[model samples]
Target chain A: MTQEVEMKEAQAPPSNSFSSASTPSTLQHLKEIASLIETGAYAKEVRRIVRAVRLTIMLRRKLKAATALAFINFALVQGSEAHAKLSAYLPKEDEHDMDVDTASSASQGFAKHALPEIEIYCYLLVLIFLIDQKRYDEAKACSSASIARLKNINRRTVDVLASRLYFYYSYSHELTNSLDEIRGNLLALHRMATLRRDELGQETLLNLLLRNYLHYNLYDQAEKLRSKAPRFEAHSNQQFCRYLFYLGKIRTIQLEYTDAKESLLQAARKAPVAARGFRIQCNKWAVIVRLLLGEIPERTVFMQKGMQKALTPYFELTNAVRIGDLELFKTVAEKFSSTFSSDRTNNLIVRLRHNVIRTGLRNISISYSRISLSDVAKKLRLDSSNPVADAESIVAKAIRDGAIDATIDHASRWMLSKETGDIYSTNEPQIAFHSRIAFCLNMHNEAVKALRFPPNSHKEKESAEKRRERQQQEQELAKHIAEDDDDDF
Target chain B: MDPRLVEVTQIFGRFKASLLRNDFVTSSNLLSQLKVLLTKFPSLPPSFQRTANAYEELQIAREIYEHAVLLSVKTEDQDAFERDFFQLKPFYADLKGLIPLSPQEYPILGLNLLRLLVQNRIAEFHTELELLSSDALENPCIKHAVELEQSFMEGAYNRVLSARQTVPHETYVYFMDLLAKTVRDEIAGCSEKAYDYLSIADAKTVLMFSSDQDLSNYVTEEHPEWEIKNGCVFFQKAKDSQPCKEIPSLHLINQTLSYARELERIV
Candidate 1:
């Protein structure tokens, strides 16, 4: 019985294969070997097939089998001491319907199943750790080592290996502003996702690729992928929710507000109740949809709720249109500062808020038409960290890019270049963006023209008061003229 | 005393008495009073200011009132009510400014604004109902008390379809189908529940914008060749375009009402 049990242990597969065709001849030979042992004879045919098939098997699986054999041999060499660590590592009996977090944890050590790949995975793992630590240089170095190690392996083409390479490359360029590397990595991911035959793998890869495109503002590429994404019905509820959310965001960015609202509502309705993080993400998307739809007051309410739920700081900073409450925005900014502990994210949030507040102040110019550009700038400067200093930095950057002429045109609508005349007349966002820059530079007249309608002094109540004052001055001048006529008489 | 508050109080007194008697003059006078209250520094009550939901509802109500005031063309004593409702006009302007005017909203806004005024009327009816219930139905100032009672019941049914939690599918199918049939057949011989059938058709215009699918076929086919536009799903005339074939009669309404129950079972 002990011998039979030992023989059974020797034949167990090192890795699971859902496809029976991938099962090795070693297993078939082991079956014959067991029968031969029962009959007390060597099976020559079984031995031949095993040796021939073993030669064609990849080196990674060979190393895995060899390591496993060495571990089994160690039991004989040291009385189970070598097997002890291996035995304890017997994977926790995996639950089939494991949630995402638990599933990631369960698969954390899956690379160990392939001994050769373990070395490559270890390097990538260390790089991920370095990236998490914000040591981008160290992470890039580790990523280089990982890619080099992968080139050395020269194994059968694995899609996971390709994805990891691009993933690492993408993150390495994130801090360096290396657009070429970033675009290359994203394109690679896009290709890999498209070429992948595995349904689940394709879906997940597409999800990642879509998000990367969105982050880089490559809307055209993202839209092409979005059009091809399968309708979300019949997917796992969690995956369905994510698919709907992405679809909704894509539509929202394209200004298809009504369609986006329907998709987002479906996502919020169906998102997993247990995952607070995902629920908050759905809420954040809703807030974003509302913002795009120009429901400013409602957006403000939703953003505050989103902030309380710790959804994201982006919503808090982006929604500067409704400055009915500033303390709320400030509180959210402070929360983001502590949560991220990254000065980049903190500074980005602060800059976004300052721009929003400035836009709000500019709106006052659009509405009542009394506030001067300098007065608004002074208020913004006092409220903000340093308004003038920031504006100068932007101007310097523009000058360096040789875009000062373009910047000046943005300030004054009347001074629009002949080339820009047609484009500036129709595109509101473009005009606003340039006008915003001009306003920041204190080109008041240019900013006013960029506005929806330049403030008509004749139309305003204050303009009426000005006209009355002018009439009084005119009457005084007439009286003076009459007095001069009497003196002549 | 704040002049606006005193005005509101005086309007409240007259409005309360009229509302008790189901008096239009009283409510119309109260509109002026309500207008004064609305025009005060804070539009809604102080308590509403503290809560987001209340603030939103007040804003919506304020919008409806203002839209009705804009659409008010009749020259009457109730013009004061229109004037009072005018105080709420800024909310509508704000809405118009914020929400880019889609072609669809032009008709729906007018209708919804009308519905908003009707809702205020319903509120006054409720107050009258409460006052009358304190003793008996023969309360002074309530002429055509039976008709008023019937209208109030119809209004209650309206609430079910209008509320947020309302099953939109059911409102579209069963309630609407029943209404169309009752109005088309002029089924005065049927049960009192049949009276609810006609109002459901009138309510469709309000719901038309809410649904993503084109529902015009349901109306056009039923009336055969009728094109209903301007948030008017019910037609007064046959369509100028080619007439669609008449819609098949079915128990679709009953099926719709059961859809929620079916979903509950499956889920």
Candidate 2:
């Protein structure tokens, strides 16, 4: 209960009051966090430590060079190696305005050996500072040193801060374009985190490794590792969202468009609303995968708030696909070729060419019950020397893939589309209804499984004899009070 | 200093010398012997045991397997290429810092890629391509195979057929020839459906066949249904194909109605 009180002290009003105050009060809050960590470590309650780390996130944006210098001077012993290194990382002139309290705190709490949690926290602070400062090379060096220090410390209290450190470690290496340099190191760290049963560390490192692999278009390796990694309930929403995004990308590249669409849509839905950029990426991919699967996504997807401008090219691309215009698709692809390549989705767009042909063939077969091969080729706008032949094969493949119901007449060079039947007369609706029911049942089962009961509530029940005894005691007290009143009279 | 390394090193040297002399039989024997000796090296993959000279052992073993892959190419033995390429993959994937980059890496990797394309194993081709670094994807050898794959998927047979003339390395010729056959077959499958008949000379040009004999031989072996009459290829039309079965609408409607009733009752 005391630790819970400490947790509230760090969590409840800091972020809300953060905007209600100025820089001095923010620095004051930063100083209070040091004491919180000290008490947390002394009491061996990790939740307090976790709360201290959470508070740093709220203060992260308001941090300046002088605040970092003063915080470092107060957190570590004055003139220690870490203090000197951290102070040197800040600008030299920012220390001119340190308040009296920070200076007194620096003099007061200069312990010879800071706790491991505090050490990792300082590393997190400096790393976030350097990365925000755009000093990636320095950030890389700092993160490497942090990771080395992290490996020697095995305290469970340090796990939360260590996970944050691992995140910045991979982020800095990625910024330096030297992720290849630390692939083996990251793997070793992941193994260590697994052995320690640090679920958050495992989740963060697994996502980082996937991002690393997918950075170089290594879908095969990413899939192999993802399948073999230990599965557990997610400990962090943000990391799980990232994991889903990478999985969607791998599935997209591997031609599993249905599964890819599900993952990408889930990722977009589960992402925090503030993460507009990530949501836009997920939506863009979901649209393309749906297009490839022969399903045009809803219009509101492209018109999503804050996503309209970035998704305009995809909207135009989707329009071209919807109409089954090969020429328009070609132009749209050419116009946004740079954007697609930058997104590393040009390979997926290249695959979309077949989908374009299939869409064109489906439209043509629907409108024309009987058409010559050359006419079909002309309608599709196939640009090859043998357009008729290419059109024939495109139609053949589409037919074989169930894109259309058409038969080719080789002797007369005509495609004879079969008469369209009413879809409602088929078992399609039955199957669709059955699937919906199954989906509802599955969701109910999942919700039931997710329902959590309060711990030991069943033990709160009272025995009948205890209730009767309590009632008798109440009557006796009432009678004694009445007898005392009569005696006073 | 390890005797197993010394023995593997000597056999690898002999393999290279025999390969250069074009004595394939002797080089083949040397390659097999070198592979067996490499298994004894503690530093190789699936073991990765560190020795005093682990780097040297790994480098030599990699070279021997690289040569063996190219040898399979030279010998036009597809099975051996697959086996040797798999054995050599760990060296490229595992030993990045141990040894300097091999000059033969891109060409051989590209060759394996082209082989996959020829076999129409597109998924594996992509998987292999993914393992390469971004810089490697820019190599002309890899770029050539990638463009060929793109063209193949786009059904641009003319470009695919023309790509054979611009082979980046000599070893690519064999796979390019096989890929050309695949492209021609793809085109053949399409043309027979599109045209009622084409002149013999037109079919020759369309299939990229050099002579009437090759055209007739292909038609006879691959599509016996296609008849050559009046100096033109007359493809078999839809006469022999099975008619489409009609959907039983009444039965389907009954099933759907029953399902709706059951759903209504449950609700």
Candidate 3:
């Protein structure tokens, strides 16, 4: 599915590319260099590689036009080393002559004329590098300056680039908790995308807007936007993964766990191999949703490659639930309490406490035919002393939930399990089964409703108009052809 | 003086007065306005040669938000408290060495942590814990919450209940009351299974209800099946109202007799 999306994206109008002057050989060398770095082979000859790339850029002055492309590749491979080199070449923001011509002259590039487009590319690369280094403050400044430059130029071609830059700028604000600034930027971007009828841009902006809303715990706003946001066909794996992940999160927050689980599972499956972080996050939410729906996640979920360490806390949590040990569940919850809270699954985990107790009661009922309520309380660790009242309530709740098969004998102060034959004939099991089926059916209906596509009224109107115009044009062509035929005759 | 500084001061003054008077509505409105003003201020504040002035302004803003959080708690508006707490969180987490935090910061931070615990947001509880300095962690207000959480998780209900008395701050009482209720409810559940009947006095003592009316109301609301008559709370209603399944003793005897006959025939 992801491959299909990628194919469609490749066929669509490209949003951003390296450069018009990019050569296949340069890209190949870049890839080779990246591989060398990945394999640690470039460590010993790092300086030599840097010098060689610099020399090549200098010899082929035309290559200087795509300097941002090379620098971006270099940053990916060289890490901090590229940051230092790029910083040395980057023009200071406050400098009056901080333009492409001045930067080209200062860097000793043989190209007499400097392309403003290349300057924008360089600014974007630098912005990316700064953000990658966790210098969000500097990245914000760089993005703002780049955006200001873009606005000064007012070039129609750079609108896409400006939108991308604005996303980073707003992202920095989000990280800093400048809520109003982030909201303002997103609203402005939303308006721009609407004006241009840029479906892909609207989709991207909507995802960011939804994220902002969720970040601030603005569920009402998020719900309002989800119902109204422009729906666009997701043509990239990253976009599709994001779209599904956001949908799943919103559904989870609304307690629509079944639909959440499906969307989250699809997101995890469609996520790129390189985006393992995103995939892991999706799985974490999926695991929580499944747990909420009274389904035990398989042990294999915790053991997936690259996910073991990140999932260890959840694995222990699942184990505690599986063993029906309330104390162990509590211990595990406390031990990894930070992990659950940070993942925003703490509320769901709290709900699991009742499940743990129910499971414990079930195990207890199976083991003993008749036990005093106080003894059951002691075994279940309900209270330290005089737990008779607490134990009775726990047992009563357990029996009500159908977690245990037993009867409370008030006079004898004992819980008695039904004889084997009597247990089978009771209507309780049937009721439980019916409720489970009902819940499943309800979830299925909700998912189907959620997955239903919105009516594409605008698209339909556009197509209908286009068809009429084409019919008129065809009739005119037919008349012209008949006139020409008469002349030939 | 910068005109913005005067505006910030006037706003802060009004916020402080509103908070003192317990006017949460006005205080929250002031906070929103302050937040907008702060958002518009350049983060790095280019005019300031050093970051000291900017950091001081940020600290003041943080304190105001902290007051807003307290006000939310006082008003029993949990959602507002959560929003205010998060709004203050970034300032605490990001401005590590720029300025010294007020003495009230740790207590407020601890109160926030306890709120998360009561809400069962353990993950976020730990996330907040991870952000505190070692010294802050050792502070009594913070340690109080950490200990309560430990006891609760360990099934030491007694300790959890006892910790309520030692709650470090006035605001801590709200969350403490919530935690106390949760603990009592868990005990109530266990008690219902453990006993057939308890005298009204014993029920009150066991459930930690201070008044007879409170215990009676609790029983009436939570356990309608429990009959409260003759000064005792009966966990189960009269036998006739209870569902009973008859034991098939005759079937068991017949099976035994058939087995013996089969043995005799084989011999």
lDDT agreement with native, every candidate: 0.40, 0.79, 0.64
Shift of residue A139 alpha carbon in model 3, Å: 7.9
Considering the two chains of model 3, state its CAPRI-style docking category.
Answer: incorrect
Q: Which ten residues in a row have the lowest lDDT in candidate 1 chain A?
A: A408-417
Report the Cα interface RMSD of each model, rounded to 1 decimal.
33.4, 5.3, 10.8
Off by over 4 Å in 2: A1-21, A42-44, A79-81, A91-102, A105-113, A456-489, B1-17, B20-22, B32-66, B86-106, B118-120, B130-144, B147-267
DockQ scores for all the models shown?
0.00, 0.22, 0.08
Pairs with backbone N, CA or C atoms under 3 Å apart (clashes), candidate 2: none
TM-score of chain B taken alone, every candidate: 0.23, 0.89, 0.77
**True A-B contacts kept by model 3:** 0.05
- TM-scores of the candidates are 0.28, 0.77, 0.55
Better of 2 and 3 by TM-score: 2
Give residue A68's lDDT in candidate 3 (0 to 100): 39
After TM-score superposition, what is the CA distance of residue A213 in candidate 2 from its true location, in Å?
1.8
lDDT string for model 3 (A104-198, tens) is 44334223222343345446556654554456777777766665565454433344444456666766665556655557667776777767775
Candidate 1, A40-101: lDDT as tens digits: 21232322322222221222232222222322222122233323323232223233222223
Segments in model 1 whose C-alpha atoms lie over 4 Å from true places: A1-114, A144-169, A175-180, A199-201, A229-244, A265-282, A291-306, A309-489, B1-267
